[model samples]
Target chain A: MRNLHTDEIIKNIKEMCIEANYKLASDVEERVRGAYDQEATALGKQILGQLAENLDIASEDSIPICQDTGMAIIFIKLGQDVHIEGMDLEDAVNEGIRQGYEEGYLRKSVVGDPLIRINTKDNTPGIIHYEIVAGDRVEITVAPKGFGSENMSRVYMLKPSDGVEGVKRAVLETVKLAGPNACPPIVVGVGIGGSFEKCAVLSKKALTRSMDTSSPIEHIRELEDELLLEINQLGIGPGGFGGKVTALGVNIETYPTHIAGLPVAINICCHVNRHVSRVL
Target chain B: MDQYINTPLTMDKVKGLQAGDYVYITGTIYTARDAAHQRMYQAMEEGKEIPFDLKDSILYYLGPTPAREGQVIGSAGPTTSSRMDKYTPLLLDNGLKGMIGKGKRSKEVVESMVKNKAVYFAAVGGAGALLSKKIKASKVIAYDDLGTEAIRELYVEDFPVIVVIDSKGNNLYEIVLQSS
Candidate 1:
């Protein structure tokens, strides 16, 4: 069995949080630049230029890309053959979030209660998902999810006969409803075929995928391309003023489900879709 | 067309503006978001004094991140405006001449803008790092316990925005939707 120290996990998580907030991932930056070149409207081009400039400033000045540093969403792939020493895994992750938000000067957006909201102060208790995997190495991915777009996400439990067309309608409707509110040119993550909750989780996971990459499954990849084209055609544009680039990319993830149900979830992420990953 | 505007915007100045005009605003404005708005609306309901004077004032719906060492403010950008729709008409009626935010406002809020001769501006949301450069100074004026959600008085220089809704109830978002 491979033994891993808890401090290592905490240290990595802390670094991931700070770096993810301070710098836009290169793939995302590239996609934004590409969108800027392709955008037709004058206002859309100007907005995309400012977005590119913002990314540069954040990297150069070591400042956050957006005021809402977002609630930390951590995805962990734990090795079956590895054992953690000195702390509970979940506690270690939360400690990392607390330290990251405090030291990085990132915003503490978390509240203690849903109804009578009170600041959590240090942005603790990150949303963590775990999976047991085959190797001796652990892979950790951190995605800071801002609520502006998170609030726009939706799920539909479709009839077995509804099929692909239903999924398309649902995604378009969600994007249309989001309009300028969720920050266009957005990144759309669609999850299909799982149970309700599982589909939601899958949609979020799909968002962590790189914009430059496509789904390995050929049919699903085609669907992603088609959705991207239709969404951009909506002319939501950058900042939703009006243009040809409404979405930077459309990512779809799927799972096999019971024959009776066809579940789909859409998790919309803003242009500043910040995520970073590390393997140890 | 792009224009330069000064804060404490008057009805005359608001009337001169129209939907789709890009503007750079200078001078003082206040910041308030969900928690602060709720508190202010509650205070107004009870006939209590608000944290700042309302006449001819502009409010920006933002909750900026805390400043790091030497900076005047952290990434400051507009939050979604529709969330503030519930309390907006009250403020507009009380001589809040302008608001800075993004997204569509409620129909009632737009009507209130028309009735009160107010205006609504949209700052590019998620462009906080770029926007913060315009804020020359900032300090919390109320609800310090609310942290980022506190009401802040800010002195900004050439802060960029687009006129999304005008005094006549003309809406830029609707115009864009129709054209698209």
Candidate 2:
């Protein structure tokens, strides 16, 4: 059995928050750099070029790539054999977020209550997802998701007969509807074949999956490639100024579902899809 | 084409801009987002004098991150503008000459822009780090308690934007849709 202190978790989470905001994961960054050559439209190329410059500036000067540093979303894979010591797990995680936002100069985007709409002052109370894995290590992933694309995410409760074609149609329609609003040159995360809520979570997880990698499941891998091709053909382009590079990548995650339903969700993320992971 | 101009735009300047025209704006503009828009709209509704001058002014839909030590401002950039659509028409009617933000505006907002001879500008979304360099100065002018949503008076130099909707109501978004 492995013993871990909450202090260590707090320290790592704090650094992860700042790191995720400052830099795009390497797999994603490589695609963004290559996108300038792939983009067909002159204006689209220009937009992509600016995005590359923004990425450089963000890293070099220690500034966040986007003003909306986003609501903190953390996913942790806790080892069943490991014991944690210190504060409650949730508070330690939030304390990390609070320090990261304050010290890193990231935006405090959260409001304590939806209706009252007062700023939380410090960006805290992050959404954390925990999974118990068979190991002695605790893995944490920090993804600060911006709301522009978050607000555009959608889920469909498909009838069993809707099938793969229906899934494709739904994704296309959502991308078309999003147009420039989702901040094109997006990372499209698709979740298929799960319960409604499960699919939504899977979709968000899909964004964290490495862009250089594809699903191990053969059919899901094919779907990812096909959807990516179709989305880029969308003419949404970079900055939605019209071009052939509307999406940097399309990632799909699937799970078993009831025979009666084939639920699907699309969690759209802009080019600034910030996520960082660490193991302790 | 890139045209350089100052804010507190006049009718002639507004008319000169067309959909798809790129611009670099230098001078003063007021920043406000959802909350401040609501408050200003309510103030105008209540027949109270709004804090900033509306005539020929540009309302930038931005909620910037707080500046770090020795920095002018933290990652400043435009936010989604449609959320402010409900409060936009009244400001345009009173004398708002331009609005700077990203995404499509509502039909009513566009129509009001046409009626008031105003323009809508789109900045590249998520390009905050680069955009912040263009903002030379910033200070909260009103609603300081609203935090990031507070109204800020900003002095910008050669800040880039594209005219998405012109004074005559030609919208670049629709044009892109139709052409494709």
Candidate 3:
């Protein structure tokens, strides 16, 4: 069994939180640049130019990509053969989060209660989703979710008869409703074939996929391409100015669902899709 | 390209501008969002003086990330404008000149824009880090207790923005959405 010390885990999580908030993943950045090249609308193209310039300034200045530094969402893939020493894994993760937000100067957007709306300073008690995997390495991913795009996300439980068409409709509708609000030329991550909550999980998980990669399933790939074209046809271009590039890509991840249900969920992210992963 | 920049936008100047003109903003602007807007407006209803002057001033609907060391502000990008639609007309009536944020405004706000001769500018959303570079200084002016939602006076220079809704009620959102 590989033993991971508490200090190392804390340090790794702390750095990951800060780095994830500050940098735009290269894959996402490259896609935005590609979209800029393909965009036709003069106004839309201008907006893309500004977006590109903004990305440069962000990286050079070492500031966050967006003001909605967002609530901390930590995904942990704990290796079965790994054991944490000196501290509970969750506690270490939370501690790292506390230090990261405080030291890195990222906003603390998490509230103590959904109803009462009391903020938990330091962005503590991150929204952690854990999966135990067969390995000797523990992996952590921090993806901060902004409110505008997050509010536009959706989940649907369709009758199995609806099938692929149903999934396409949900994905397109999400983009349509989101329009400019989700920050156009957005990324669409679709989660299919899971239970309701699991579908939501899969949708977020799908966002972690490499931007240059496509879904392996040919039908799903077709769905992704079709949805991307249909959404751009809506003319919600860069900043909704009107152009050919409304969505950068549509990524779909599917799992086996119950015989009676077809569940679909979409986790939409803006142009500044910032996330990072680290192994400790 | 005619570049007209006003440090502190005056209502008269704002009311005079037409659609499709470029304006680079500078100097002080306030930051506020949903919760802060509600409280400020509620105070206005009670006949209380607002925390800051609304006349001829720009209010950026943003909740910024925390500032790193030696930095005046953090990644400060615009939130969606429609969410604040309900409260905008109230501020317009009180002499607010312009709004700086991204996304579309409500039909009601556009109507108010026409009637009041106001303008809405689109600051690049999700470009907080880059945008913050233009802000030379920042100080919380009101609702300091509100954390990121607090109203702040940010001193900026050549802060880039596009005029989305102009004084004539020529809404870029409507124009683009319908024709495109």
Model 3, runs deviating above 4 Å: B1-3, B15-20
> What's the best-to-worst order under lDDT?
1, 2, 3
CA deviation > 4 Å runs, candidate 2: none
Quote the lDDT for B56 in model 3.
Answer: 79
Model 3 Cα lDDT, one tens digit per residue, A1-280: 9988988878987888888777778899899878777988777788788788877777788777777877778899999999889888889889998988888878888888788776787787888999999999988898888878888899999999997888888888888888878888788888998799999999988887878888988988888888888888887788876788888888889999999999999999897776799887
Question: What lDDT does each candidate get?
Answer: 0.92, 0.91, 0.83
Better of 1 and 3 by DockQ: 1
Model 3 steric clash pairs: none
Which digits, one per residue and each the tens of the lDDT, describe model 2 over residues A1-280? 8899999999999999999999999998998889999988788888888889999998998778999999999999999999999999999999999999998888899998999988889987899999999999999999999999998899999998988999999999999888888888899999998798999999999999999899999988999999999998777778777888899999999999999999999999998998999999
Q: Rank the candidates by TM-score, best first.
A: 1, 2, 3
Q: Where does the lowest 10-residue lDDT sum fall in candidate 2 chain A?
A: A232-241
Q: Could you give the TM-score of chain B for each candidate, in order?
A: 0.99, 0.98, 0.93
- For A46-99, candidate 1 gives per-residue lDDT tens digits of 999999888888878767899989999999999999999989999999999988
RMSD of each: 0.8, 0.9, 2.0
> What is candidate 3's CA lDDT for residue A104?
81
DockQ of structure 1? 0.84
Q: What is the lDDT of residue A158 in candidate 2?
A: 90
